[model samples]
Target: MKQNKLIGLGVATMAAFLLLSVNTAEAARTDMVDVSNHNGYMNVSDWTGMRDKYGVKSMVTKISEGTFYKDYTAANNIATAKQAGIYQNGYHFARYKTAAQAESEANYAATLAKQDGLPNNAVLVTDVEAAEQQYTPLTTNDYNNFIFMSTVQKYGYRTDIYTSGSWMNNIMTVKPGTGWIASYPYVVGDKQWYTGNHAWQFSSTQNFAGTTAVGNFDVSQLNDDFYTGGQNTKPVNPVTPPVTNNNQVANQDYAQTGTFTANTTVNVRSGVANNAPIVATYAPGQSLNYNHIYIVNGVVKGRYTSYSGQTRYASMGYIPGGSFGKRSAVSNSRTYTVRYGDSFWSIANRLGINMNSLAAKNGKTINSIIYPNQQLMY
Candidate 1:
């Protein structure tokens, strides 16, 4: 009887130990470090150090902006990151004045990636932000997104849209696809927006000095499963289906435009041009009129609607500050403090200014030396 009792006790002890191990693993999985652009410009050696020290599993880096593409640094960054054994992806900051312009930019980016050989775990992302002026046409923005996504799909690359939840739900329609939501919630009511998302930017001021990747704002965090074969898995194809109702046309509503029903199951593609393939599908009755529509390669693609209820179009022929305030003369008065790993080119890209302009603003050449915490006016 004592022998049997001893056996039973051993089994119970083993079960308890297993449970404890599982709980410990779950706790460990909760901790993640996000090395986004907030780290400024890190060279290959710098990134490799972070990967080795912090156990960084993944990274997202800026690749291009509007028509201006990053120099060899982008490819160098990706290659260095891969060598350091980290998953790497690229993002483009949208700066389209029209749908056509956006489409052109997307195509250019795809070509660059193809020419340079996309990284193994690459995810082509669209970073959408508001234009300088509020009155810019909504159609232009929508079409620009469409073409950008389309181009990405055409290149046989995964795609994702990175934006805030409010922008996704209110300003833009969330088609059937994943999103990198920038909703930082340190506590209750700190949420930036409320919506379903694949990854969440938990905080912008993470302290990583002691841990690893030091001297950078802990600017973002994501779900543990993000880029770990979960919903945040890099999209195999970023394109949505093509708009099926090519023949359906509606008048521009000056007020609130009621949602337009998709006459047939539609494929909402990602790119602005006819390059990328379909990434997701929208069924009949799926609303498109919630936003505005713009012309892309002569076809109308629906876009986000504005507060005035009218669909906006791209300023195709207009010059900057001409009828519409599509362009802004950059103010050379403001100054920015340089951070560790920062380069003039990287700083210029982040500031949305040309390298020469940035140099000129600071009374230095593009190759002028800059140091961490040094202020440069632009």
Candidate 2:
């Protein structure tokens, strides 16, 4: 009896020590990643396994790049994330030529957010960097940054800026509602770059297996002090996409008037698995036509582009009422302002109007180059 008791006490002591060690290790971690495609392309189906395998708690995927690009992998990744019951948000790669251009990009990105089912609560981050032109001067150039984020905010989406500290202080005058700092090689447990209002990017180009992500992706995490359980500024007025589209899509019996925006920039896989090879990518705010979104267990799922490339699926609240389940209807007589990539042809197709009638009504030549902010009646 004495021997058994002594042995039991020894085991208990060892177990306690091990538990303390584990806790200590956890305590030593100061930064975590808000995962994105910058590290590699992540598939939607891969999220759960990636989350469980890598212990990802919060993340935002790459949705748009500049005024024209969209990430194809966003729909599946976002939808699957909702199904997995995780906090998933989105970010946009900004390339603005002017303040007006900035606002246009923001509006376009917000539309993508709505299409992909990103609610007002999901933080929409603008990735400011030199896309069209490298080395944007601090003076004169930075105001566009504010325009980009402010417009996104104006549209009722929670907005953040992902830029360097020097850029935040020197390049841009007005700071974002949330500042996602990019300070690589952070020391474990040392959050010197962390401000009470900012998240830090500790590393880039890190090799993380199992995600099937391509390229060197960035790893960032929100400051524990400022993290709102990964919630963004909710919109005062949320606009939801229609549940059905007028066009009849091929192969699928049903038609949805609604389209989804790409919340993250990832590669579209051939299968609904992460291990599947990357077949394609989507640009930000690039619209996927009616009835192309996938749904599983009431959560919106993205279809393979090969099977259906034109549309992406949006997400509802993983927590319920994330976007208020509100849908925005297309106005037939409404006027749409032309922006960077606007053409009468594209506009008419987007609005389901006749191109010839639209051009004749607007007195525009078919080959005319429409400038940014130019309004046209469809």
Candidate 3:
């Protein structure tokens, strides 16, 4: 079955080995991988292949970040995985500094989860580590954590807290729902800091041989219940797409002004090959425009032109004709903190900005050295 290939905000690898919820051996345990849009584009078939080859059954995908930001691939990833018969959960990368903000973020995550096809019986995780480090009002995180858990519970979904011992001990006082503890030396069962934890993410630098994914994989081991597909062994998220009344125009030539409905795992490729460099990602039900369509050997395909005026392409099966068209125009004209390994070229390329113009806007050269946590206004 195709599982959700969504990953979470960076969780440091686990180092310490403790006991498991059940008495399970540590030597021969299957690991689960978490991925996000940053891990690159992957279709349902790609995720299924990963599961079949690596025995990865459970996943934690990034659905929403804060109250404003939403993962571009959350909808499709959740839908495809649930449809493919895999254990999947959704998480929000929280940026709240107060209890009210945390509650709002929780509601935001739940709303997006519902829109993205996240199952009701699955876990909804709040990534609190980032907010603990970035947000202020030191005495407010405990209340924030409490409100977050309560809000998610109100939505008829279980809440899971993903954080380290330091954050738990230093920042927050109240414990939320279930725990997804992240510490070193990969431990199982009741952790030293938190008593109730379902899984332990051991390492973030490990790579999978069965897959061709770049960068290190965030590796984790699930408790017996989680390894067994959390709550529902046969979790279902079947697609019941609304019936379209538009007449099918067979062999209709692609037009410059034509729009297409993105049906999840939709990639905007720089070229026609499956391995082509991806230009952008679109959520399911998002309406996208294309420059041309290609019919190759009974297969339907379409070309999408990027903001850099580069023509990208994708298979047309997920690119059905639609009247709800909206072209992507990235105008992230706000201050953004520079993250690790971010470069002018990479940022410009990702945001569809002209490289030289982006540098000029920052009052820096195209080759200026960017450092971590440095804010850039574009």
Candidate 4:
């Protein structure tokens, strides 16, 4: 799902015979799989062993991006695929190309799919194959007039479009039967395709055969009311969480002890959420000598104790220019761009610097791999 490769080949063999026959001679369709956080932690017996070994039923997942990341394994992969009963949906890798950045990335993916449970009228997707929407190439009236009408007239959910298949046949405007596409034909039944869109994907590598979820997933084909019809049930569109508690632990507005630093290579965890349990990482200018900090929801964390004594927590990032527990050291001539859940240690903790001085001032190295508009320089 990272940059979803493969494109042309006679327009993907005329988009696989124009779109609909997932092999086995004809009427076969249904499977699905989309995941994010690069497919990690998929319990519930790995979503019932990928739905009893691939019949898969449904699962789009991803959840948020653009209006500044938010998919720390999207609330436990949408509650472990609803306790293995499957049928999940909620995507948003898009980094918007306007209409007020698609209404603030559709209110940050319908408020992280109503704070990651993604149920009421499921289907949220709009991944639009980013490269910043193939460099502002969003047409089809920017996905049917402003990103699926701002996630269905202000978040009632149920929108689609996952792109590619030559950007849904040459950059957007996609509206026929509707959007999912991807295309990878080396042999998805060797011919007879078709697409008014309901879904295609045709393999990023699919290995449901390795059962308990070993790796190669991305598969798709779907259609039969792709996740139960009636235009996906629409009704519950309330959306509010900019933070009532969000990522919890927010009552300390006071705390004392300072001297933090680890602005880039972070993860000390064992607690402050994002699936905890790291217990130590530190690096980029490391230092972390806290005694207690906390603010959380607005981000700051800190705690510190371990040497095996155990307390842990470290993430003294996000204060922007100093003061919450004192970070302000930056300036190697600050400049960063790489967005959409960036990394190189999150642009060296958002430019406070030192992930090897922002990977040697952008010649790149803390294991590189930056994207979305890429620019980095610190």
Candidate 5:
């Protein structure tokens, strides 16, 4: 009897140990590494070393800005990182000027990425910071942010917003397509800032797998799927190519329409009427790429060429014609200004206004034009 009892206890102990081992293995499998470029610069060799040594999976390289940090080393870093088989993402340090300015920067960045042939794993991120001295606040910062983020999404690129925890929760109320949180913990048991972020930058300098520098990181491979998730979820919307003779319209399916509020010099093309591509570099809030049609004297201006390339124009006649049309009779009426990571739908929902009414009030459709600093009445 005694021998039998001892045998039973031994069996129970073995079973518990086996179950614990299984649980441990499952937890280890879920661990991942994500890294970003927050410091002024990153050594390509150092980045490569981190990846190899600590299994670093994803990276966000800083690009350009309207501030003193003019040029973005991201393009060069991305090229180098790709050669070594690491996934790369491009991010802009947003110097929030106006909704229109932010949109232009986003559009310009997208154009750059398109020109550069961004990697299959590439994503676009907006880094919102107000540390610089020459910053102006917008009334509808949250609304404008929605426009900027949505515009990036329209370009077939994944989008995310990177900001400090307090800024994310307080100053900006817009929900990003995804979030990259930066919160430095002073104590070991501090609560994390971003609960739904795909990637978290826990500390500035963490020695992981025998490497050091502001290199502490984590990558959620699961988040990669989330970043690109919309590609599968949303049905592809087809765009009608404007009828033009001089230049052949290759693919209008990917064309995006937005008001340009900036006045940077853009390329103005020579041939093609109505939809002629006028590549004009712009200032902060000049309207651009109006659905391959530009309105002059209430008529469609064909195609034009710019320095960047060919762009289609959309005539103002297509925009609700006149402002006098019956203002949308939706339940709520409000206007929102632009911010770093906003979208049209997001703005409408936050203000408790019907999205259709908001779009109609703006003299556009669901995906119509709303530039930075411009007011959209519902």
Candidate 6:
């Protein structure tokens, strides 16, 4: 009976060890890629090749930089990654060192993310690795919390942090968050990275196996909570393409009528596609009266009939350089004193008012020349 009892105890111990090993293997980190305009345009095949060949399970796209720049390739990246069955999120290149600046940047990044179709549940990360932060450092996590809460309260997306190990160790007063931490060991195999982090960017020059991509890429190991629980739950304001027969879209998704004024010269395309022929162009402050608009394939489009009786589309939202224009709206009553080199068109465009209304209120015509300091009501 003593020998039988000894055998039973040994079997029980062996079974417990096997179960522990299996659980560890199951919790092993999955790989991911974070891309920006530097990576150029990734097509469906590029994403698929990364997924199928190198075990890339998710992607983090750079959506905006600071407050002025928007990553033009972000929309395309999100769309193609979704096609390749890769979960998608976004990160903003943070330039904020104060709470106010942090709030502004959060709004800019969140707006761009929504415009680019980043899902509501996907993590919106603030990249805090800029050198400027070192010189003028943020003393507290409160500034970052401003960014985090802005996305949560206003945009309905949670936030994350990405920073170098040096910053995490020496610079930051408080640890940023339980997000992706970057530190290159310059070694091989799955290595442990920062403590209490969901993901670790182990290498910035990882050459994935069998990838046709030319240069080295930034790769991360995600244990959990890196892919929004492995799903993008809510797609924000998705724009479906209109019904088309032979590339000619017949109807828009909705009928939206408004006047869009170009803040800069932007192309009026023949169709909703980016490669469509340029039918016309809007000069700075020139207004286009559009009957309807469509958000197709991540581009906001407006339809107008040209003089030749053909329908033309104008992009009213974000493009490579900037937004084509904005909706023309004047919210307050104001007066303006004309300055040097100011014309009716120039003043109207600058003030976002109607040129005709400006001239009529000032008892002048568009062709009338007025001297500087002339008071005008708008």
lDDT of 4 by residue, 173-261 (tens): 66778777776665554343545568777766555432357676676766546554433322111111122223555544445454555
lDDT of 5 by residue, 184-214 (tens): 4453122444556665444433433222225
The list of candidate 5 runs beyond 4 A from truth reads 1-45, 67-72, 115-117, 131-139, 174-177, 188-193, 207-224, 227-378
Per-candidate RMSD, Å: 30.0, 25.6, 22.8, 21.7, 26.7, 23.5
lDDT by residue (tens digit), candidate 1, 207-283: 32212244633233344344433434321211122333344333222222233344344444444332334445446
Clashing pairs in 4: 16-193, 17-193, 17-194, 18-194, 18-195, 19-193, 19-194, 19-195, 20-193, 140-173
The lDDT of each candidate is 0.48, 0.51, 0.57, 0.60, 0.45, 0.63
TM-score of each: 0.45, 0.47, 0.49, 0.25, 0.43, 0.51
Ranking by TM-score: 6, 3, 2, 1, 5, 4
For candidate 2, report its TM-score. 0.47
Rate residue 139 of model 1 by lDDT: 56
Model 1: number of backbone collisions = 29
Least well predicted 10-residue stretch by lDDT in candidate 5: 13-22
- In angstroms, the error of model 3 at 285 is 51
Best by lDDT: 6
lDDT by residue (tens digit), candidate 2, 1-378: 100111111111101111111112221121234444433445543455334334344567777777777766566667767775557678887778777888888898888887777656677887764533235566656677777777888767777776665456666543544677665433334334555446766555333333333444455555552334544422221222212223322222223344344443434544433334446665544443233333322223344222222333333211111221322333435566676876777777766567888888888778777788988875
Compose the digit string of candidate 6's lDDT tens values, residues 1-378.
Answer: 100111111111101111111112221233678888888888887776566434567889999877898999899999998898888888888777777777888889999999999987888887776655665545555455555556544787767777666666455533434757676553423346664776777655544332345555677777564565554322211112222234544323556655678765667888866447777888878876666666543345777665344678886642111245566433344467788888899888765668989998888899999879988887
Q: Please give the range of 10 consecutive residues that has the lowest summed lDDT in model 1.
A: 316-325
Q: Write the per-residue lDDT of candidate 3 for residues 1-378, one digit (tens) a residue.
A: 012211323333434331211132333233455666765554565456445434457777788877788888777777766665557787788778777788899999998888888777677887776734445554677667778878988877777777655555555543443566655444332333333556666555544432334555565556546433444322122221222223323343444335566655455556554445566766777755555665332224567555454666654441111111233333436555677878888877765668898889889998888899988876
